[model samples]
Target: MDWNDRFAASGPGEPGPPSVLVGREDLVPTTGRALDVACGRGTVAVWLAQRGLVVDALDAAPAGLALGRAAADAAAVTVHWIEADLDEGLPVTGGYDVVVCQRFRDPALYPALAGVLAPGGLLVVTVLSVVGDAGGRFRAEPGELRGAFADLDVLVDEEGGGEAHLVARLD
Candidate 1:
């Protein structure tokens, strides 16, 4: 089944902040633009809008975008939701104060993430990884995120329990 089918079959709770930024929301700027790549169900995107950032959320599934739009309306926030596949390249333009890509791993787009960051912008990314688990084609390798985004000042870098997450800021 496609992502749209998967999301249609699922019933998830309300959108929330990126899991990587749960306790460290201070890393997010309150008044600048934000982008969420592969923004499934618009969870993190809507949450960013609630935090006072203008948000752009992109996903491959229209069902997921609809879910996000509902959550945004429920929260009385605005988010620009776009349905597009990231394999083609990032569909948005200009710099953003924050960029978030959770549970999506695309090495080819790593540089674009940094390129889209405004000065001092924060980047939060989480992907399945080889660390502490049997590896899969979709998982990141050890130090993959750090090496891809070495230009950024690393704030949080962790790999374990089948996941890798990085939180960094542009210098």
Candidate 2:
């Protein structure tokens, strides 16, 4: 099913905050621009806004973006919500102090993701992985994120329980 249909079926509910950012709060800058790619329901984007960052949240599903807009409004934070398909490549370019892509895997976008970061910017990413689980078409193989983001100074890299997480900073 398409994302719009999937989100429509799921109905209304916040997805809560990003656990990756929660665990590594110290790594996140209090001010500057941030982008949350494939930002469903805007949890991470709103959270970043609350932390004093100007945030841009992108998602292809209108239903999801609507839910995200409501969530952002409820939180009394402002987020620029962009509806764009990542398969077409990143809609915006460069100068983000933080870029987050959680639970979304598109290896093709890795270079663009890295390119958007300002110097010393933080990147937080998490995705389904083959580690400790059966491999699937959507899952990343072991060390996939590390290999893809090797140019960054990786601070955290952990994989298990069918998921992989990475927090890195660009030089």
lDDT of each: 0.90, 0.90
TM-scores of all candidate predictions against the true structure: 0.97, 0.94
Among all windows of 10 consecutive residues in model 1, the one with the lowest summed lDDT is 11-20
Count of clashes, each model: 0, 0
Superposed on all Cα atoms, model 2 deviates from the true structure by an RMSD in Å of 1.4
lDDT of 1 at 59: 92
List ranges where model 1 is wrong by over 4 Å: none
For residues 19-112, could you state the per-residue lDDT of candidate 2 as single tens digits?
7656568788999999999997777888889889999999988998998898888889899999999999999989999999989999999999
For candidate 2, the 10 contiguous residues with the lowest summed lDDT are: 12-21
